[model samples]
Target: YEVNQNSGNENENGNGNRNDEATIHKSGNRRTLHTTRGCTNKEFLNCQPLNLKGTEGAVGLAHWFEKMEFVIHFSNCVVECQVMYATYTLLGDELTWWNSHVRTVGHEIAYEMTWKSLMKMMTEASCSRSKIKKLEIELWNLTVKARPKMLQKAMELANSLMDQKVRAYVARQADNKRRMDNNPKDNYVHPGRDNILTVTLSRKEQRKLLRVEPWT
Candidate 1:
């Protein structure tokens, strides 16, 4: 009996290999290129590769992966290389700082893997809107965890955002107050029992108070 070479599982050229690599010629040399670029550098830094060994190392790797996944998902975009590098570099230094201080506090050396810690790492970099939204979502999710430490960290972040918003609001309110103060009234009235009280200050006086251009 003759063997049929054109089996359905075989390639057109009759190669029985299931995994086929693509070949490209560059500089007159044949080279094989993988289908995907694999994990990004940020991903590698954040997560351990599949080949990583040992349970302890694996745990640390998993921690990094979780923290980074939170950050990336919160930010809603692949962090730019420069920002990622800077943030991770800061995190490395912060880890060193925490380790150095841990001994003095009588606490064992613990990894500084917190959202606030990560935010501190990225302080020098401005996060995008998507990232901020993502962070908020992550914080909301963590609220259900109900751990005191996580809740405290979330509160701290919330307070920081609130403080910034309050400052902006106050500044806008002051601007509006100043605008109103500088506005000139065409008519004036005096206060009585059930009457209105309107004090017409001179343009110069108003300008002195509001620090705005006086109406001529």
Candidate 2:
């Protein structure tokens, strides 16, 4: 289906496939929707809201997610290679820092980051708005600069929590595989080249944060 989108006219081709095109026009008393080669998603999201009647669909964010998950349950190195192991592990480390600061006493870590709601914000929502994505990056940069002084305590908590989360996730995957192996007749979706399963340090960390993660 191909829709002019601008004129609210719908056009369709014989075969069932989408032939969509989006455009933006501003200034002058004229309007046009053009498919240009230099357009980018960031630019698309940054566009201002249009008061035009049919322009909303053209400039609006497609509030949808790729239902596919990226985590694979195999022991093979292929699955491991696809994931951003160091980066994601580092994120877990940060979460660990927060947990320890709250629980530990005399050896308490008092990192004063204003983004305590960060993890929760990510877990609860996923939107196509560019502003939110930009805000997240801004918050992260702030956190880096506002990091706590007690490096030893921070590292200790981070590493411990990260390891536990990874191990537990792997164990769950292995158990699921064993169940599928035993019940051959049961329908099971095996990890494949096209399959995408999301993975993270515990369920808390898995989110559609800033775009899809490397592995996903």
Candidate 3:
């Protein structure tokens, strides 16, 4: 497949600066970036191929467009090279259609065509307006049906979290009470049951408990 600047003025103007940077050329599954013609100073080992056949429908076309855009950005593909490389990835019927399109439009006109124009043409060819509208309606219906359940699930999760926090607080308070009970400082006589004793023991009681006799 051949891509020409026939698409738009934007590509031509962009080519002035972009071409100065790098041009990505595919070699097998990998792509290499060349700053100058016939130079292979930098290589990208992880570059994936952008193979898109015409039969993929609207969803597939959107996926392919996303992938192509990612590849273009990742490879830093120049404007002309972007159109050329992306078109080259088209397979089977898509390739045939593009070739026929190029021939009908003439190479000079097709060569000047921008990437945006090609995308518009491809989208129109792959998806009909009625089909797109049907898809939108289906998506809207699905979302509406699922929204209430989703909200209910969210509320249940929030209430569960609050219950866990409450339990944790109660457990912490219980643990603190246990610790206080085990401490000797908290072993005071109960004022309601025992003889009148303030929160603290008298000095005599303290000495008696320690088994130390008071001096005269």
TM-scores across all candidates?
0.20, 0.19, 0.40
lDDT, each prediction: 0.47, 0.40, 0.71
Candidate 1's residue-wise lDDT over 1-216, tens digit each? 222223432223336444333333344344333221233555545642222111223345455445555544543323333233323433443445434545665442223334445445333222333366579889988876768887798999999999999999999999987877787552333346223222344555777888997558
Model 1 lDDT, residue 161, Cα: 100
Per-residue lDDT of 1-216 in model 2, one digit per residue for the tens? Answer: 232342453332335433354455654655555542332323322332111121122122121111101121121112222122211222333345334544663222222222223323322332332456679889998888767655767999999999999999999999999998899877555666224333334333544454445564
Ranking by lDDT: 3, 1, 2
Q: Name the TM-score of candidate 2.
A: 0.19
lDDT tens readout by residue for model 3, 1-216: 333232343233434544345455776666555453221113211467558877677787889889878876776655666666778778987898889988898877876778788899888877664486679999999999999999999999999999999999999999999998899687775666555444236766778789888788
RMSD of 3: 20.3
Query: Model 2 — which ten-residue stretch has the worst lDDT?
Result: 61-70
RMSD in order of candidates: 25.6, 38.9, 20.3
The candidate that wins on lDDT is 3
Candidate 1 residue spans exceeding 4 A from truth = 1-146, 186-216
Worst lDDT run of 10 residues, candidate 3, spans: 36-45
